[model samples]
Target: MTAAAIGASFRPNELEVRPDGSGNLLGSLCRSCGAHFFPIREACAGCLSEDLKTVRFATEGTLYTYTIVRQSTPAFEVPYALGYVDLPEGVRIMGQITGVEFSDISIGMPMVLVLEPFGTSEAGDALTGYRFRPADVTSD
Candidate 1:
């Protein structure tokens, strides 16, 4: 696919897929309180300040917690791994866990963000999204 097509984000406000095929999760950084929030909040929850800036979050993080999802809406597959990843910015992001099995995931494991094809848009174009994988794992 062309870079323009591949860079189409599943959730444009949350993920940014660059032309070089690299990407970062986007969030809001509170300049007033030095706090960070995922999903790009308009205000700081800590200080209730509107002085927030859009920032790209670090790809590396620690797996804080997780669960095996055996049930979900038709849009999602069953028995997928889900987890909270604590980034260096002190924000915890919930995402699907990949590159590791459900039985192998553990608390405090090093994780890294990975961009992939999520699903097709209404126009049948590919949409990019993110998943967290063990940092030690490499794509085959």
Candidate 2:
């Protein structure tokens, strides 16, 4: 891993990382129907219009559902909380849950996007990814 690889976004197309350590999740906003989609779409799903634009999604959302995975591939550690959060833009995003006990998490709880070290690359370079945390919880 090279020094430049540190703090790099795991998926640059979906996430934008700033030099000041602030970042946002990228998505597409449909100009015709006022809809938003993750992974940035080329056309509007709601109105079937090609008039769409890239936009930064809101960081806050509501917890929709979750589960704790006890087993997975070697790249991921077991017993991590995974959940879908419904953002204000009307998109549900899947991400890991952190900063709170698994038992304490509940549906409808407010969550906020948090950027952290996701994992290493094939070359052992550090990568930045995102997780959802309880909105009331402050970072250390």
Candidate 3:
């Protein structure tokens, strides 16, 4: 598979975190409707316009909804929290919640995106994925 296809399969529409370790998340914005999208798209779904612009998301958002997955799945690790986060720019994104236990997640909690290794790409190469963590958690 091509690199683009592998990236698309691994991250879908979310920004590509560079392998060199810059740790930047690239997102897509709709120039026609002001709608933001993760993983940058060539076309704007909101306005059906082809003029989509690429930008970096703030990485911070409010927790919208979440669930604890007790069952194991090939797509993700077990005992992980999966949820949608509402970005300040009015975009909602789906990602896994990390750095906290399932018992601590609450609706409307503040979250920030963090780059972490998720799984391998479709081409059997190491792939990095984004996960949400409580904003209050410090690097220390």
Best by lDDT: 1
**lDDT value, residue 102 of candidate 3:** 85
Which RMSD values do the candidates have, in order?
Answer: 1.5, 2.5, 5.2
In model 1, which runs have C-alpha deviations exceeding 4 angstroms?
1-7
Model 1: number of backbone collisions: 0
Model 2, range 11-61, lDDT digits (tens) per residue?
A: 999998776666899999998989999989998878899999999999999
1-140 per-residue lDDT for model 1 (tens digits): 55765748899899988987799999999999899998899899999999999999999999999999999999998989999999999999999999997889999999999998898889988888999999998986
Which scores better on lDDT, 2 or 3? 2
Rank all candidate structures by their lDDT, best first, as comma-separated numbers.
Answer: 1, 2, 3
Provide the global lDDT of candidate 1 against the true structure.
0.92
Report the poorest 10 consecutive residues by lDDT, candidate 1: 1-10
